[model samples]
Target: MEIIILIAVGMLASLCGAIAGLGGGFIMVPILALMYVIPVSDISGTSMAVLFVSAISSTIAYAGQKRIDYRSGLTFAVAMIPGSILGAWTTGVIENRVFFVSLGIFLVLMAISINFKPKKSRDGFLKPNVSRSLLDASGQRHEYSFNMTFAAVVAFFVGFLSSLFGIGGGSVMVPTMILFLAFPPHIATATSMFSILLSAFVGTVSHAVLGHVMWDKFIWLAIGALAGGQIGARVASKIPAIAVVRVLSVCLLIAAVRLMFKG
Candidate 1:
């Protein structure tokens, strides 16, 4: 049955999303469209709703791991809220082809950035103004820095991307954090999920208000995504930090290609 398929897809997508901090909306949107679950106009709305549920589940698990950067997450969340609402309002009005292509280009660039580290921090790479030192559940210590002004600016747009693409913006946020903000993969993934939870909530509500969410379908997806999220957080915790970035880079490239074609 379609419900069964939805559950399966939600679980698989959420598992991948949680591991990569993508939040699964991008994966779900394309498939849901193919299934004719709803009109394309409403697809993003539905995806955002499901994404919020998945994020909630994953954020809780990541929190337990003590991997999330709460200060950075809150700063990003505050900036992203407005963009989430605005993106929902403009969803059906934008040109899908152009947006998709632009996002694809951006992802490709991020992937390249990840594969090739700058020769040195002085090689014209961004350096953060504020520093943080965190000890995760594993008792491994991580020290990182970020520019608050820059992160706020990026998060505002990240909120728009989350709602606009229904991808939770983690596809973009994780790489930015790791590459630019000096966040370790574990911390980046966890922090990205935390920020995404807040953005997804705003985006979901905006879409629901516009009557874009299909509650009947959302229920099944939620059930599956919820379980998958917990599993993914566990899996990610076991992977080495370098491996996580490698996996994230691969995922970004994959999502970029699919999104371009979907557009």
Candidate 2:
């Protein structure tokens, strides 16, 4: 029954991740603590493992649909490396109460960021220094520009938070890309998942070396997450941009409230 519950939770997390590029760690970490009574170290490790599996599954679908921005995603991934290492190192020293409270507040901020709708680029709301245009599977054109420097700074922080908490940084990346960098919602979600693959891999390895991961539980959860990720990618492809943001914001807000009380 416990295994069954993990699988169900993994699927739900993956689905949420695929839609919003959150990697579902935000959902799984809290659930593992509240329901399964897993230790913080093990929970973070397990969540990272599941996130890697889900990222692969979702990235494949997004890639096929041509939704991923390889250049920008690669840049973000490169910038995140140092922070990922630092975060992994710091994770062991952090107290659970502190971690929970910080994560809760961060999630609330992310929820607000996602819900914020900016004006047109010409209105000077967005930095127009860098220009990019992507054609999705449906041949629809999405265009935007962003400040690379701002993105690098944001990516570094995202990497640190993701490694420390095992939340896969998708929650941070998607909103930052859209709100801060002026990326299209769908492109931001896809690119966020694409970039997270590397961070998740590094974080997973770091946790494994510390003996924080449960290999037995990881296998079943991974299997469920892969399937869910594929389904979510498909659903996201069909949804409106505003609908996706709504889903992202609502989920983050609920998760934030729950984590705040848990702390």
For model 1, what is the alpha-carbon lDDT of residue 209? Answer: 93
- The window of 10 residues in a row where model 2 has the poorest summed lDDT is 119-128
C-alpha lDDT values of all predictions = 0.85, 0.83
Best by TM-score: 1
Best by lDDT: 1
Q: How would you encode candidate 1's per-residue C-alpha lDDT over 1-263 as one tens digit per residue?
A: 98999998789778889998889876888788788845665888888998999999999999999999999999999999999999999887888888888898899899888867552342112556788889988889988667878888888999998897687789878888777777778888999999999989999999999898889988999888999899998999999877888888888888888788887
- The true-versus-predicted C-alpha distance at residue 35 of model 2, in Å, is 3.2
In model 2, which runs have C-alpha deviations exceeding 4 angstroms? 122-128
In terms of lDDT, the poorest run of 10 residues in model 1 is 118-127
Q: Roughly what TM-score does model 1 have, to 2 decimal places?
A: 0.95
